[model samples]
Target: MSQSDAARWEARYQAGTAAYAAQPSAFVLDWLPRLPRGRALDVACGLGATAIALAEAGFDVTAVDIAPTALARARTEAERRGVTVDWQCADLSDLRLPPAQYDLIVNIHYVNRDLTAQFAEALRPGGHVLFEQHLRWPTPVDGPGSDHFRLRPGELRHLLWQLDILHYAEGPFDGRDGERLALARAVGLKHH
Candidate 1:
């Protein structure tokens, strides 16, 4: 992401258009008990819902986002919830992660197909990746205009093909915001 893009996201956060659920999404919560508790990374962690939830669930967490304002808010919430998280601000477009460093990785909403490959590199042999995003089906109603930002049918599965896809779904889902959307979700586990 460019400085201009960062500035745009910063402005969005400042304008309060970046609001996200304070609680972690149900999909994420569902996989909590099934995942190993260890080093975790929350990619594009907007309000730190997943990050904080992981912390509370006894996982050491590091979260990243592009906007400082959003990170600040996430930090405050984490502290308020009595959880500690290492938060970093970085462009997801140019994201890189240390090899075999995480036991769990959660990415919700935000889409950066390029980063999917890195998830495998960042996870331990038994680590997992949980991802969900609006799909480009019947056209997006209120989302990025570019198909590049939306997942095409089976694209996510193809992206995580290297990993064992333990869970996968694609269809209309009632979003936490009460909007119905075509969505795709993947939960991949690394066995190597």
Candidate 2:
């Protein structure tokens, strides 16, 4: 991603017109009951919507993002919601997270292929991972240039095949911009 890209996202968050939806991602909500009660990490956590949701659900959440402005918004939201979360203002791609430190890792609407293995390795025993992102498709659907950031067919599942996949889905969805949602929703026990 370019500096401009990061700046653009920061600007969108600073605009603060509810850039983040009040609700958590559908995949996270769907898999909430099955999630182990422990520390969770929200990668590329823009504005802390998912992080706040996880905290509300009794998970010790660490939300990481590159933009301090965005983190500020997230902090404010957490304060307003009366829940606490560790908001780390760092680029996930470069940050070093402790191994096997989280029981759950959630990456929604963000795809960082290079970080997939690292994320999976960070899960503790019987940990779960909830992933949801746009898919690359030939026909335009969600918005212009979505294909650029979206995943290709079977990309997420294939990348996460090492984990015990509990759910997988890929298709066009009406919600969240005309984009296709691909989820590699998984529950796997780390081999000790």
Candidate 3:
């Protein structure tokens, strides 16, 4: 993406840090106990919820998002929580991370199907990726209006074909602001 993409997200995030939940997704909290502590990456980590949580859990963390405002807020919150996170601002919509550089990768409530292949490639052996995103459904919800932005049925499973899926679920979910969203959540482990 170009500077236009950053400007667009910057405009959205100008609305303030309340754009998403203040806490990490339930999926992240649930799987924290199962994941190994190591260097981690949080792609499009708006407001730093997941990134902060990972840091608090002792993972050397790097978080990236397009909006500087959001990253600012996230940095503040992470500091308030007394956790260290390397917050970076970038347009990861066309994300490409270093190969086998992280032990864990996290993506919450964001989609970049184009990045799935690189997701697995970015993880070291025995590493994991915890992902959750809105899915196409017949109901109005709190996510992208376009089907292209949401995962199709069974798409999450297929996207992580290079890894072993440790957990997966897709259905109506309670999201921020009591919105009923069809979400797909998955935990995939890379086994070399």
The numbered model that scores best in TM-score is 1
Regions of model 3 farther than 4 Å from truth: none
Candidate 2: where is the Cα deviation over 4 Å? 17-22, 143-146, 176-192
lDDT of 2 by residue, 81-167 (tens): 999999997766566768889998888877677787776688887888888777776666653365667777878877786687777
What candidate 1 gets wrong by more than 4 Å, as runs, is 139-142
lDDT of 3 by residue, 1-192 (tens): 678867877887786645565678778988999888999999988888989989999999999998888899899998888989999987786667889999999988777777777888999999999999889998677777889789998999999999999899999988757878899999999997
lDDT of each: 0.87, 0.76, 0.87
Candidate 1 residue pairs in backbone clash = none
Q: Write the per-residue lDDT of candidate 1 for residues 1-192, one digit (tens) a residue.
A: 789988998998899886764568689999899887899999988878889999999999999999999899999999998999999999998877889999999998888877887888888999999998878988456656777778988889998988999999998887677866788999999996
State every prediction's TM-score relative to the real structure.
0.94, 0.87, 0.93
Better of 1 and 3 by TM-score: 1
Model 2 Cα RMSD, 1 decimal: 2.5
